[model samples]
Target: MSGERSRTDRTTLLARNDLVFIDFDGTISVTDTGIAVIDALELDEAWEIEHQWRRGEIDSMECLTRQWGMVDLARGAVYRMIDSFELDEGFNELAEAAIQIGAGLVVVSDGLDFYVDRMLGRLGWETCPGEEVIKRPRRCIPRFANHGRVTDHGVEISFPHRSPDCDQCGNCKTAHLQRLRAHFSRVIYIGDGHSDLCAARFADLVFAKDALAEDFAQSGRPFVNFETLAEVNEVLLAPRTR
Candidate 1:
C-alpha cells in the first residue's frame, strides 16, 4: 500500500530471472473496466458486440474497435468513470511483495492502455505512455494493452501490441509472455478470463480464477486456484516447505 517507494528503489531489488504477468480488468481491479465503460455510457450496441466476441464470432480487435466507435460520451466523463472504479484491496500487497522478493511484475491486458495507466497511477506505479515501454526500458510496472485516445467525437482505439500472426486478442497476451519468458528463469501468470487462456498455458506457474480456472479445470491442466491477490501473495512469499 506504500505508494511512496521510488521506481529506482524497487527496480534495484528486482530479480531479473523471475517475473509475474497479471491480467488487468478482473484480476487487479474489482470490476472489468471495459464493461463498466460500456454500461456507464449506455452503449447498448456494445453489449451485442461483446457477445459476438464471447461467441468467437469476431476477434477482440474488431470487437473493441466496434464498441469504442459506439462511445459518444465526453472524454472527461469517460475518464471520470474510469477513476470511480476500485482496485483489488490486496493488489498493493502483492505488488509490494513482488518488489520485496525481487520478482518482476507486469500487467498484460487486452483492455485499453488509457485506463490501465490511470489505474496503475492511482497506486503510484509510474508508467510509460503507449508503446513507449517497448522502445524504452523503465523501472516501472510495464503494461501491454490496446491503445486508446479520447477525441471530441468519442474514444478511438488501436492495437499496437497485437500479434502479427494472431487476431483473437487485441493485445496478444501470449506473445508478450513468450517474449518475456526468454529472459526469466520462471514466469508466473495470474488471470481470470478468456484473454488469459493462451498465455496461462505457456506459464511456468499459473494462478487462476473464474473462467480461466473453469477452462483449465475442464481441460485437466494443473493450476493453483485463488480468490484474491492476497492469496497469490501468500503463496508467492511463503516459506518453501521443500
Candidate 2:
C-alpha cells in the first residue's frame, strides 16, 4: 500500500471519469500478505527491516534489497508458502460490489506480483502477467472467474517498480498508482504497513490501519479505521458521485 500524490497526479486522478484505487496484501486480503511471504521464508527478522523502513531509516527498496538476499528458497518454495495464506473474509464480495457500482478497481501493491497473481488465481481471478515478471508468454487460463467482481478478460496486472533500490516487492504499488494517475478519477488508498506510505498521500480518501493508520494520525492527516474487507465493502457500496 502507498500514496503521497503530487498535485498533478491527485488532480488528474480525482477528476478521473471512472476509477478506484486499491491496495492489495492486507487491504484486499484479510492479512498482510507480505508478512506471510516473509513468514513462509522464515525470515522472522524482516519485522526489524520493516520497522526501520517505517521509521524512515530506509526506503522499501533498500529494505527489500537487503532482506531479499537473506532468502535461500527458490521461487517455487516461496509460492508454496504464500499459498497457505488465509485470505481475509469478504474480499470477493467487496470486489463484486465495487464493480457493481460501475467503478473500475485497480490493486497496486509494493510486493511481488508472482505471489499476488497466485492469490488472485485461487480467488478465480485470471491475470496476464505483465512483462516485468515473465519475459515470455505463459499459458492463459480459464476465464478469470470469481464469485465476486470478475473482470471480462482479467484484472490489469502491472508491476516491477523502477528505482535506485528497485527491489522485488509483492507488487510495485507506487509505480502502479503513478500510471493510474494518468487516467483515473476518485482514487482511494487503503493499506496498513510501511510500504504504503508514499502512495497513501496520493489517495482521495485513505483507509488506514496498523503502521500506516498510526502514521496518518501522527502526521495530522485524517483516515478511517479498517479491520476487514467487509468494512471497506460497506464504503464502496455507499452511494457516491463519481
Candidate 3:
C-alpha cells in the first residue's frame, strides 16, 4: 500500500506544471555563500552592507561593489573558500525530486555567479538549455581597491567593476526571475535571509527562512516558513498543480 502511494505521489508531482526557483547562498547551502566570500578574503565589514541592503537603501550591486573593495585576498583563495562550502543536506534530493516532477529548477540569487556556479558545479547540477554566464567585474574581490569610507551603517569603498550596468553583486537574481516568469507554468521560490526578499514578491508560492522569513510573516507576504530544505523537500514530494 505504501509503495503504491509513493508511486502515485511521484506521478502526480511529475504530471503537474511547475517551476522551482531557488536562492543559492543560504537556501541551497548551509550558510550564506556571499558572506563566506567576504570571510575568506578577510574582509570584516560585510555585515554592515548586508544590513543596508536589507533596509533597501542601496541596491545589492552597489553594496557588493563597496564591500568587496575591502578584501585583501587572492583569486585562488577566494575560489577555495567558496568551494569549501557545503550544500544543504537534502538539497540534492530536493533537486532530483524537482527534476523528476518535470519542474524546471531556476536558481535566482542576489549572490555572484562566480561562487554560485562553483557551488552548483560541485553538486553536478549543470546548465539548462540556455544558460548564459553574466560577468560582473571586480569590486567583488580579487579586483582590489585603495580608498575606503566609514559610513553610518558600515565602512564603504569604491572599486572599478566589470559589469557596471549590473547592480554589482556576483549575480543578477531579479533579472533572472523576470525571465523565469515568462517561461514557467507555476513558479515556487524558496529562500532565507535578507537578499531573498526582493525576489519573493515575484514568485507564485514562496518558502522563506531567517530574516527573510521574518519579513514575510510581518509584512503579510504569502509564504511557507521552513527550518530546513528537508522540510521543503517533503512539500515538493507532495502533489502540486498549476
Best by lDDT, which number? Answer: 1
Minimum summed lDDT over a 10-residue window in model 3 is located at 136-145
TM-score of each: 0.86, 0.68, 0.71
Error of 2 at 40 (Å): 4.5
**58-118, model 1: which lDDT tens digit per residue?**
9999998998888787888878888999898677776666666566778888998888888
Consecutive 10-residue window with the lowest summed lDDT within model 1: 1-10
Off by over 4 Å in 1: 1-16, 129-139, 239-242
Task: Give the alpha-carbon lDDT of every model.
Answer: 0.78, 0.57, 0.59
Task: Report the number of the highest-TM-score candidate.
Answer: 1
Clashing pairs in 1: 15-102
Order the candidate numbers by TM-score, best to worst: 1, 3, 2
- List candidate 2 segments past 4 Å from native: 1-18, 74-76, 128-159, 163-179, 238-242
Q: What is the C-alpha RMSD of each candidate to the true structure, in Å?
A: 7.1, 9.5, 9.0
True-structure lDDT of candidate 1? 0.78
Per-candidate clash tally: 1, 26, 7
Candidate 3 versus truth, CA RMSD in Å, comes to 9.0
RMSD of 1: 7.1
Question: Model 1 compared with the native: what TM-score?
Answer: 0.86
Candidate 1: Cα lDDT at 39: 79
